[model samples]
Target: MKAVASDSAIVLVVDDSPESLGMLNIALNNAGLMVLVALNGAQALSIIERITPDVVLLDGIMPEMDGFDTCRAIKQKLPNIPVIFMTGLTDSEYVIKGFEVGGVDYVTKPIVPDEVLARIRVHTQNAKLTQSAQAALDYAGQYVFCVSNDGALEWATPHVHELVDSLNGDAPCAWEQIQQLLAPWLAQGDQSQPLELTNFEPPLQAYFAGEHGSNHLLVRLVTPKKTKTAEALQQELPLTKREAQVLYWVSFGKTNWEVAQILDMSPRTVNKHLEQVFKKMGVDNRTAAAAISIRILESDEEAVG
Candidate 1:
């Protein structure tokens, strides 16, 4: 039995029998989780309404409101929380009803400690993953503004408008705004290539490119900033503002099409940006570009006092 963390997950264990409840508490506690016991559906509902648990271990057979009804009530209140049914009754009807009521899985009792632990781990891991992914998506959806190495302004995703009022102070620039903002950040030595800005926001770095034969060149931005000091302490890389936009998607492992979707640009436009990124980073391929960009971004973080 592993000792659960103090901040370990809170588990709701609902069973009518004290013997069953005791057995579950031992297993859950050994696995390093905090257990809340309920002998009946009404007690379980009261706990759930006040404070949600990470996972619910529900017994299918109970007096008054049974596990099926309990599971339904839990789901209605906290849809994201997972429920695992524990029951001596292994009938197909009961099992199916468990799922219909939003039970994630069913475990036949007498409960094996290993089986209980495994089920708990599975649901907890899933809950954690879902939470992390949602947080990442939410951050990505927010407006972000970056200053190019060359002191030009570049923008991406329409959401960014909220962060910086001006795309170009003189006028309202559209998607084609990349060309105007990043001219100064282009590499001087390599006319065709661009400078890579290794530091931007703590954890986020950028790379910029010069004017290609077309009206615009692709941009890339990468940030791993966890704190304000972390973002501020890193030394700035030479990337232009335009290249920073392209780099942002590259770091997220987005394909050209996905990047296009986020930026509301055509796939062709995204591909064009990639070409500029490859040239600017002096990497012949996307893999090399991604590797170098990550390295530069990670290594540039400053030690915070």
Candidate 2:
């Protein structure tokens, strides 16, 4: 049987029984989702390692490893991937165990094809949004510097501002000033660190900088680079800590009031921060702001790669 083609979602079906596997494959494929089947947990794990499916429909009973253990292992290995249990075991205790194993949902056997397809659609959509939000969060913590062909700073994340201030007594200068201030450091080759210069400054002064695309732009991150906390913070973009929080919600497509609820603030406060974000980003609306943020994030990933 052939399923419809939905380029956006990939579903992995794990069941030991050939009949059950075939049934799911037909159903999922008909619904326009790409489907992959594994007869057991071991095979499922191998498939997962090779291809990160949007969602996994796992059977509770399997040889070598049962669904719960498999689900736990998958979550540990790939925390972001969502798993849904598809099983004949409908006991409440079994359901609870599935949840404990990190299963996002449960569907009993003798499955209604429509219901299964609907649930898959819902979970896949949620997963896509969650991934996007996490990407945005990572983008917010990192340093992003776009340089012109002349080696001037076109733009820098706010964290770069902090780094510049620490490097020079009269810091927080415009992008042009930053280029001049860090000229020596920028001259360093790919493999070198600015240890000698940083040693003269505070010990906490550290940076991870890299060049991308024909050396047109240089991206730099400065912090106590060795610390775990600093690394985590560095993965985020250059937003005020609060703005980072707000941007997370924005990436999830939340309204101002919804964001306020999540942040435990009033809608007015959320709007105020949003306005500041707009002004700083030089974007007029939320859609434009989100697009710009995503672009900055994608660029950061390219620089890292």
Candidate 3:
């Protein structure tokens, strides 16, 4: 799901009054938003359980469960869902209470359709952008996470959690220990110097990528890939130093252009080195030569282990 919100821009409109629902449904639908209707808080929660809406337009006062209680419950289940309260309750306390219960915005009764639509558009667009960012991170196979200002884990990708497990070593940090480990680094704000967690073998480097939003501090985990030294590869294989370096990156599936950037050489020079690597290793193609490199690397790792 990439967290929350769908591409269709689904908006769940919850209100005890049929009048409000119909009016907003027409307005939202006319604006090209798919609207889901709910008669009360229970109905709203039920709808949310089945499908995540882009923004929840909830009535503030309803029978059984008021919008405040409903907002609290909704936040508990899906904190990413933005709830906006709409009711006749226009008092200062009501407005303040709405936000305290997780309402992102509040609109009083007799609300203009245009005003409500404007608010929904803003929240819905924000939610979609967030989903896109999370999906992009997953697509790139990145170990990244976002933490609250208090250093609590807000949201993270699966790979980031795996990195955290490795950083925990034998004792899993769970949550508290994780907060302690990350809190200090949050304050350090040093982007150039990577935060080192040396408790585990090979260790890990935490690079702060800066803030994602107002409260989320973005972090990326850097881990060393299994690679052999170019010198060691040259000595082990029937190839020169340049050929070894070329083959080393190529074995990891790097293109000739990419390998040239890493090795600080021209693309033509990289292709030339690759040709030498193939000839020396008695292989007709790069794939066959890569097989030889992988064998050498695996053997080296096995010996070290």
Candidate 4:
């Protein structure tokens, strides 16, 4: 049987009505959840700054900062904590606004205990999965950032803002430059590309590893080993110089067309080189070749780290 986290979970309920707060508190506490209550938006923001909760149940209508404003403030401080809006507003526009302000799910007012519990369970589980993924990325020595289709910054690791600010004084400009740099790969749905950091003293070379989710482009940032020379890769593998280069880019999830752009070779030439690489490496496809290359690279990283 699958295990559900209950005892250690913390839920923050932000509402103005004493009745609503009392009902929610009683129900959530009975389920083995540690419940935190705030009478208004201001109080909720204060609580969030002090301690992080796993999930937040925010009331839509409140005095002096309403649900939308509070949720936005909460998102700015703790983006990973899921916010579920409990509102009497049945209008679709209000629901849309709730989502825009970073609400993960909505519960109509006069909340049903069972319904609210179910929604909380689902959103909390998702929040946990997201946290786990981010932790894995951190363990692997990478930072993550996500952007919307329009190139607006959605979320990023704390280190990312500092790095970006150092790169360019204006973060918007930096993001624009990155978007332009990745325009070609983005067109082809390529998930990873080498990023040139021009401002650093040593001129760090970072790779942008991206994956397209439902609405945003999720990216992982890693500083790869400086040696991408075909000669170096050829020395480690049985492949030729061009084959090694092709395999190196393939390991970063670049499509043949994108690889062609990077290597300044035609797509046909890249494919031809890949075929030879497969023959030498005894791999059936590009994915297998990439897997082998990644293993070798990760081994090198482990040895160095």
Model 4, 51-92: lDDT tens per residue?
678899999988889989999999998888899999999999
**lDDT of every model, 2 decimals:** 0.66, 0.69, 0.77, 0.77
Rank candidates, lDDT, best first: 3, 4, 2, 1
Question: What lDDT score goes with residue 142 in model 1?
Answer: 44
Comparing 3 and 4 by lDDT, which wins?
Answer: 3
Q: Local error of candidate 2 at 144, Å?
A: 6.3
For candidate 1, what is the lDDT?
0.66
What are the per-residue Cα lDDT tens digits for candidate 3 across 1-305? 22243345778888999988888989888988888999988898888788777789889889999889999988988887789889897789989999899888988889798998889888877875676476547534667777776677767777666655655464355446656777887777665777765555556566777766445677776654455676767888888778888899998999989999999999999999888887777889988988877887866342110
Superposed by TM-score, candidate 2 places the C-alpha of residue 250 at a distance from the truth, in angstroms, of: 51
For candidate 4, the TM-score is 0.47
lDDT of 1 at 58: 94
| lDDT (C-alpha) at residue 183 in model 1 | 57
Q: Which stretches of candidate 2 lie over 4 Å from their true place?
A: 1-6, 142-305
Assess the local accuracy of residue 205 in candidate 2 as a C-alpha lDDT between 0 and 100: 29
Positional deviation of residue 254's Cα in model 3 after best superposition, in angstroms: 30
Candidate 1 at residue 273, lDDT?
75
Model 2, CA-based lDDT = 0.69
Stretches of model 1 off by over 4 angstroms after superposition: 1-6, 138-140, 143-305
Best by lDDT: 3
lDDT of 2 at 65: 98
The list of candidate 4 runs beyond 4 A from truth reads 1-7, 141-304
Give per-residue CA lDDT, model 2, range 170-214, as digits (tens).
Answer: 564433454554555555544265322333243332243543323
**Cα RMSD to native, each candidate?**
22.2, 23.5, 14.8, 17.8
Candidate 1, residues 1-305: lDDT per residue as tens digits?
12223457889899999998998899889888889999999999898877668889999988889999988888887887899999898889999999999999889989998998899889987986675455335435543333344435433433444322343342344323443434554535333443333322222233543332122233444433442221221234335555566666676688989988987889888888778777766889878877766665555443210
Q: Extract clashing residue pairs from model 3.
A: none
